[model samples]
Target: MKQQILFSFSLFLLTFSSFYYPINTASTAPASSPKLAPAPKSPSPASSKPLVPTLPDTSDSTTPDDITKILKKAKTFAILTRLLKTTEIVDNLNSQLITAKSGGLTIFAPDDSAFSNLKPGFLNSLNENKKIELLQFHILPQFVDSNNFDSLSNPVETVAGKDPLKLPFNVESLGNSVNISTGVVNATVTGVVYQDNKLAIYRLDKVLLPLDFFPSKVHASAPVAAKAPKADDHKDKSSSAEDNEDGETTQGQKKSGAVSFITIEGTRTMLVSLGVAFVAVAMI
Candidate 1:
């Protein structure tokens, strides 16, 4: 019975040892690590470029106003444009527009047809100074609108002259029509050529002929014939000539008498000298 008990216990011990050793070895083994994500790619210095700045556009800005350009665009003011350039009034008007105190100017521009209506050689007949004055006569230092024609006084002043008698003109309004009179010629404002806050231009049917160019015609009688010279007048003129001749003769006689007196005095002087020499010789 004792032998049987010992064998059974030994069998139990062997089984327990085998089971515990295998479990411990499994727990001590190393575990597998998780994989790392790849680093993000960086751009190369040679391929990368700095951003450049851009400038704003200025092409949309408004351009300056030009008088010649305006007239040229109108196409009907060719002759007037030529006159303006020849007289250099376009420059004056532009400069005045810049420095104007009243902030405006009014121009009574004559069209090509208006110039054609003038007499032949009319423009050529005017001297340089007259051409300038003719141009200035059409311009007013102040701006005047079509509606304000009645507000202006009669015989309105212009750039041509300050004296009312020289380049004097009258502005009269007949409802919608405006008439300008210079006592020499009457013209009506046909239409407005251009208008702005700084400048106003109007069309004229006829050139405003100032009194300095054309005066009122007056009939005159024939000049009185010179009164025939009277016989007494001729006699008086002849007597005056005879008296002048006598005066000349009297002057000649006085000169001759003075010459004789001088000769006699010179002879006396010579005689005295001779007498002095004779006395000296006798003393010796």
Candidate 2:
């Protein structure tokens, strides 16, 4: 009886050990290996460079208010304003001029008097795709006072075309002039007079056009060829010519000629003759 009791106890111990072993093993499993750490963040890409703003080519320093007020009061300017309002290009150009930070732009604004000479369909045609070009023709790349207009050189390039035109002109303060190469026309302002620092207003006899703005069927024209000598070239040529002229006459020769040309009585007849000969030689 003792042996059987001992065997039964042994069997009970074994069954309990089998059931508890699995539970203990699961509890000690190290918490699912601490789940892997998350990946580190990557750095951001670099930014692109910014673009620079370009300045508009102009020289007139008049304020937008001045332009607006003048245009509003003048009959010809009012017509142009109306035309500009209807055209996208012209409207944008006006807006640019108003908002431009750079001062000093010379604008050759046409007035109602200018439109008087246009054919019925001419204004309408300009209102079409050529509005930008028409607006550009009136703008000079530099600032020029009314007094400097007479000194302007030919072939002044305008924003109207890829190439420049030869502006044929003979401007006088009292005379009408047309720089066909530069596509500029100056007309007498007749009754209009400028006051204070304001520009002189004018009623144009005709509307200005770009050299290439017209269609071939209407009036095909070519850009003015560049002809004015470069500054360096002109300087070099002038210096060379002067050097040649100076080298031809030595100090000894000049002194001899002076002695021969002067009379003891102090008459300058020989000197005058020599001067005339020198001038004649220079002309040749």
Candidate 3:
């Protein structure tokens, strides 16, 4: 009976200890395993900006105002433009403008109507040198504005030279009106075509006819008329016979042929025809 009680007490103690302590399932997990990290996210297309193109810079580019271009654009100076080209004064004026530092040009530009008002055969009567001089006579080497006419003295020098007896001209200002006298005809400044500090162009009512061109105004003394020489009755018939025998003209015959050659009138007519044709073609 004492042995059975001792064994029963020992078994009770063992059951009581097992019931007080429980088995841990989390502690049984593997300690060697590592934790995994989450994946990174991609960026959205809506967050980006668009690219733009750049433009070119052209702030400093500018063109010059040429004389011919100005006249051409004006449309009334067509005949004058043709004359300028024909005389090559356009090239000379452009070059002068480029080379001259302080000097500029003032032109009394005659319009097509002014040219039309000229007497017939007047332009045709001028030789090539005279034609150039005629154009030059209308120009002043220095620029003169319409307001400054009062400041100028009489006998204003021109590109054609200011000879008191010949090419001398006078500029008179009455209020706002300007009158130019060449001792042959008086021309009024009708209007201002173009004006800059460097260049000045004025509209003229008529072409400036220099005093040298008009003998009536230039010459103070009237000359006596030349008398016709009396014909010689005596003749060298032997020399004439020899020339006729040789079938050649004598000196007298040669002189007669020269007298029958193109006269000033004939030349004037030819030039008038040519000028008419040229003007017609240019207008077309």
lDDT at 175, model 1: 63
lDDT scores of the candidates, listed in order: 0.76, 0.53, 0.76
Tens-place lDDT per residue, model 2, 45-149, is 642322112112222344444444555654346777676566544455446555666544555566676777667787666545677667666555445444445
Prediction-by-prediction clash tally: 0, 13, 0
- Model 3 alpha-carbon miss at residue 103, Å: 1.9
Candidate 1 structure lDDT: 0.76
Give Cα distance to truth, residue 141, candidate 1, Å.
Answer: 0.7
Question: Which pairs clash (backbone N, Cα, C closer than 3 Å) in model 1?
Answer: none
Top-TM-score candidate index: 3
Ranking by lDDT: 3, 1, 2
Q: lDDT, candidate 3, residue 153?
A: 84
> What TM-score would you give candidate 1 relative to the actual structure?
0.53
What tens digits encode model 3's per-residue C-alpha lDDT throughout 1-284?
99999999999998998898766767997787677786678766551222111112211223224677767766787878888888888788877777777769998888889888999889889888888898899999997766677778878999999887889789887765788988778998877776666677777879888878888777753346797754442245665677676666566667777776757668889999999999999999
Better of 1 and 2 by lDDT: 1
- The per-residue C-alpha lDDT of model 2 at residue 184 equals 41
Q: Which 10-residue window in model 1 sums to the lowest lDDT? A: 51-60
